[model samples]
Target: SQKIEQNSEALNIQEGKTATLTCNYTNYSPAYLQWYRQDPGRGPVFLLLIRENEKEKRKERLKVTFDTTLKQSLFHITASQPADSATYLCALDPPSGAGSYQLTFGKGTKLSVIP
Candidate 1:
């Protein structure tokens, strides 16, 4: 029985600061990890993807690190802004042969940027 957990709480921070969110898991191994940005009442948009062999992945102001040994991933947003405020989700692709490419996402961490 594998499980994924995120902050589960809103993170409030000042603009231009860096916001870090954590994602932890247990049990099974995943083929890959993905991070997504989701706005209120909308589906998540893909941000970064890291494979089991990879240590880190980056996109623009965002960075994500995957540690298979620890069964965890860390997502970072640098120089944050009000527009950057949103719920971030970390998903893991189930081991191959599951019959789908869909991802299992954590509950997500809500981030709020202050002016």
Candidate 2:
């Protein structure tokens, strides 16, 4: 069974600083690593995805890194603001299935940016 873990503690950062979150998995190797943001009472919104072959990926003020060997993924938000505050989740598809769209998500790390 594949298990994913994120920081159970909430993350707090000052506005304008960079916020980095970690996700770790065991027992399986996924082909893609995905990051999502979820606000209270809302569904997770897709943020970024990095393929197993890729070392890193970036979009706007967001960046994601996947290290297959380490079985970890790091998600970064540059120039963070209060509006960026949300629970971030890491998800991955089943390791050995073709046409499988199922994804297992981490417990998520809540982020709060203070001004």
lDDT of each: 0.90, 0.92
TM for candidate 1 is 0.92
Best by TM-score: 2
Q: For candidate 1, write residues 1-115 as lDDT tens digits.
A: 4689996578999999999999999987798888999999999999998998999888899999999898999999999999999999999987678787677889999999999
Cα lDDT tens digits for candidate 2, 23-49: 999988898989999999999999898
Q: Under the 3 Å rule for N, CA and C atoms, how many clashes does model 1 have?
A: 0
Reference-based TM-score of each model: 0.92, 0.95
Our model 2 lands, by Cα RMSD against the true structure, at 1.2
Error of 2 at 68 (Å): 0.9
